[model samples]
Target: MSAPVQVGPSSSSGGPAPLEDLEDLLADIGDRVRAERQFRGWTQAELAQRAQLGTVALSSLERGRPTLLSTLVLACTALGVDLAHVMSSDWREPERGPSMTPQQAVVLREAAAGGSLTEIGARLDMTAAEVGSTLTRVYQRLEVTHVPRAERRAAAVRMAVQHGLITPQKRTS
Candidate 1:
């Protein structure tokens, strides 16, 4: 026979009760972690071994026990959760803005041409320091760590397409 379940005292009774909000949050986190681990086909013992943590600690964490930030980070790392995805404030790609000024576009193109920052700046009638600062802001707006050559080309192409600087072509046989 199944044992009878005991219900805890409710908050309405003004007696000691479970912290529902905290409990719910912990339960949600636990559910996510458990689901991810299970989806990866990892048993608690295997996960513990791979994470280099004790099975009991792993179990407690999986069960949503309050754990240290370092412990949680270690566990997440072991589970292949890119900490950057959690820590980054903005992950989504931002909407493209208006095309940059002609001078700015020229500066970007020159930079993309593999010229030194100083050379590009000189060609664009700007100082190397100014060019560096401008590039930093541009990169931040673009949401990329470092612009690749192909990405620079793509940006130029996009700008040209947007400003009617380049005409669309029909496909041919």
Candidate 2:
């Protein structure tokens, strides 16, 4: 993976973004919007209609101008990606992200790979018990708290994949 993009408050600057950073950030966001729209095989006009936005506004946003939150939400919702995912590439926003955290998404993505808790924990650099506890929280959040332990992993994995939170795990050499 490419090195994670640095976003949010700058550690060095720690203050207002210079005009340059602002422009760069907007362009970056616009690129993400464009990519997702294209990946979905959507014409700009099609997404604009779905987002209830004017094609002009969509074009402007794609050009990386700071726009309204409603505009951002409409774009993300149309693309089936999380707003948080756009803000910080680390997280997958599940349909709506209110029910989960970035850390939770990471853990769930790892779990979906099909492994015992111990093995998953080893990969995650956590203890097996941490994996179980984390998954328990995920289940509760997903409202599948009653799903039996035997099936929870598969079920959560399926949920994640269906929500576009994670791709189904694939084996590779």
Candidate 3:
């Protein structure tokens, strides 16, 4: 199997983005996919069925692992989000903000992966309330608490992904 990609910032000159840059870009795209999916209250399987993609494929793409561009286009279309907006390379706003703590990142990542608060809390050795509180703090830190209460989780995941706190995890499924 090929080595997993490493996610980082893009190069300024922009000849060909380094492998790390590509990794970051994929993760960014994945974040957008996850955020959109969450915003619509769709699970990976639901989106996958809509897009005619496999659940594993959708999961991999949402986790920021490398995926075919066509698959991404399919998912974007299925989610009803503009492809260009989701694929934008400009990450300036989040990059300028403070970074999230490791715990915060883990919490956001698990949420983006569609983990229930209780499930995530169990995995992290915390109670569901603690998980919810951590997510609330993340929303405050990312300044996204102003978002509608129902959408706050999605917003936090999107912002955390943009801030580079949530890189692609190794393929686990």
Give TM-scores for every candidate, taking all chains together and pairing residue i with residue i.
0.30, 0.44, 0.44
Candidate 3 per-residue C-alpha lDDT over 74-151 given as tens digits, one digit per residue, 9 for 90 to 100? 565444344465668752332267467888888888877777899989888989999999988888899998999888
Give Cα distance to truth, residue 62, candidate 2, Å.
Answer: 16
Candidate 3 structure, TM-score to reference: 0.44
State which candidate, 2 or 3, has the greater TM-score.
2
What's every prediction's RMSD, in angstroms? 18.1, 14.7, 20.5
Tens digit of per-residue lDDT, candidate 2, span 13-106: 3432222344565677788889999999999999999999999999998987667844655565455444566878676534464255677778
What value of lDDT does candidate 2 attain over all alpha carbons? 0.72
Please give the lDDT score at residue 113 for candidate 2. 72
The C-alpha stretches of model 1 lying farther than 4 A from their native spots are 1-20, 69-86, 89-173
Clashes of 3: 0
Residue pairs clashing in model 3 are none
lDDT (Cα, tens digit) per residue for candidate 1, span 1-173: 12222123333743323333444444556677778889999998898888899998878766767777345445444433444454678656545664455555555556655566798788888999887777655555444435584475456545554444343344467
- Residue range with the least summed lDDT across 10 consecutive positions in model 2: 1-10
Reference-based lDDT, residue 42, model 2: 100
Higher lDDT: candidate 1 or 2? Answer: 2
Deviation (Å) of 55 in candidate 1: 1.1
Q: Local distance difference test, per candidate?
A: 0.58, 0.72, 0.72
